[model samples]
Target: MHKNLSRWREGEQAGRRYAFTAPSPTRYPWQWYWDSCFIAIVRSRWDRERARRELESLLAVAEDGFIGHIAFWGRPLDLERAVRYNVVRRRDLTTRTIQPPLLAYAWRIAVGDPAAEPGIAAHHRWLGGHRDLDGDGLLWLLQPDESGLDASPKFDHVWGPRAQGRRRFPLLIRRNRALGFDLRRVADAGGPVVCEVLTNVAWSLSRQACGEPSTTPALVARLWDERTGRFVDEARGAVHRPLPPERVPFTWDTLAPLALPDLPEEIGRRLVEETLLSERFWPGVPLPSVALDDPAHTSRDHYWGLRRYWRGPSWANAAWLAWQGVRRLGYRAEADDMARRLGETVVREGLREYYEARTGAGMGARDFGWTALALEMLSPRAGSGSGSA
Candidate 1:
């Protein structure tokens, strides 16, 4: 894993010494927000200084608490890719969207880097102020990609198949930069907003890492579907207490809230037995991005550059996040089991971007960076993070 991670590392690109690892050398040459966070978590295990510098390089482009998703370091921004992603080399060349706010957790776990605190706090404030269109405890995602479960069927109801809104990824940066990324009028005009599950779970955990308290109204009241026993995306309107059978799409994010420490005892345990450790997601591999019984579920890596990247593959980052929550909730046996299988999968698959959830077949980009998190899952402190933070 370390060898693969080192092979994918990028540094001194485009006349800069900023160092960070690309998710894949061939497929994903650019730096990604959340991918860097996950990689840094494992990179700390090998060399803490390198991990710190990696995050520092990733955050170099952050301004006014707003961080874009991708940074084209060695590559130059061109007319075609620029128009497609809405970025220009001369004018802050990165998309305007944010990924999961995991920097705080990564920094905390990597040993309290104070440099990340202000930006982390400001990023949370940006989300709280700009998102949450309804001010519910749950936050709204202006675009599907912001949740990082890109192209998952869980969002088909919002943007149809393949998350059509992704085409607008670049526009957010232009508008925010024009408006100074200020508190008011942050969201682009006429974009759809849904209170997504994964973003809120990350929000819940990262906010705690910053030592910030959660907002009012409570996520349980807005996002938790008691009837379905999973977290569902809420697109405006109060979720009735009892959701009808199969009322919401079940995807990997269904188990994401398990990472939240504040989750109730009954809720967390049920999430463990009925969902995380259940046969539905644990078909053969430890966890699949989408539940096995979901109508859109599939374990094949049919699409790569096109879309639908997260439908049913087993992602190392997803497993690490679930393992964090599962172990925190006192299900060490199940968490350890997942860690063992995940480490073996990494060994068998050789650090690909994602693997087949059911058969453990390698898929997506090879020498993928975050698959290194399988090692973190096997660490002694793997279960150290709390549902509280």
Candidate 2:
């Protein structure tokens, strides 16, 4: 279904060999952390060897235990764009921040090469050591982009108003750059830091996959809001002088914990019956980054002028994540329906960066890579979740 994925493939060799899928050839040439994980998962369907190499390429760029959100492989980079976007150090050509630690999850589901386990463990360790600011078992995000739901309304409070956040975004970039992307400096200087729900959900899954002790799932359970019946994001600050990450918006991010197999009975039930089945999330598109009823939810990604994304669009990766979670929770019928809707949507509209929340129409970048994740949903399964709608 995602045949264009092959067209988005690229490689790097200043001296070493590296190959990975680009989110988009023209728009996003750099390899991203979670994007590669999603790409690797789907890549395994058609080509197992390439999937392995794609992850290997991603790991080759990890510096110490930390893996940057974006890996600017190949020394020849657009220095201006690199600096403007995110580059902790020009020499490393990787961001100082991290994405959801989905490497182990991807490896197990896609390749499971025993050799890659060490790198996976180190990446997980790096996160636990550096990103977990207050021993809350949840990792804190230094920048909004680190959440992979950049520009999501959940973070609008960080930079004042959502619209003003655009102008102030560069200021945040400059501030992080000034500190050389040091965790201690960034956390202490924190105007706003977050313990994002989606990120911790991914971390808990990956950490458990790597056999690391998981205090995150328990902490994530604590984020549940009795009033909303949704788990909210935390806002923990610097390790030097730490404070718990406060509650933020209760967006679709609240549903991420459902992916866990051991999700609490009541929490998972409310998420499915109240949120997923309701009009707010399932109006037309199976799900949106933000809930449909949310005031911040808009049809268009106005926040991003040209590359607008993640505000309210229905992303394939997000759907895939949700599908995996719901299915694991024994909601087989509902999970299959989600896969059917997303698979059908992608078929009707071409693979794009994001889709319209209500119509499932394509939006953002063209020939997107991770949207290829739909292949898994469309694949043959042994049970009721087997076929697409």
lDDT string for model 1 (1-389, tens) is: 78888744555654556678888888787788888888887888878887887777656766566667787776666666565453434445467666777777677776474335676677666677666576664577655667888777666665543253345434544554465533235444434456777877777776767777753227777877788787777653222132343755578787777777777878878888898777778765666888878778876545544545788888888887777778887777888889899888888879888888878889888999888888777875633645534
Those runs of model 1 whose alpha carbons end farther than 4 Å from true positions after fitting are 7-17, 78-80, 86-91, 113-116, 165-190, 215-217, 236-245, 303-305, 382-389
Error of 1 at 340 (Å): 1.5
* Model 1, backbone clash pairs (residues 3+ apart or across chains), number: 3
**TM-score of every candidate:** 0.86, 0.89
lDDT of each: 0.70, 0.72
Highest TM-score model number: 2
Off by over 4 Å in 2: 8-14, 89-91, 113-116, 161-165, 236-249, 304-306, 380-389
Model 2 TM-score on a 0 to 1 scale: 0.89
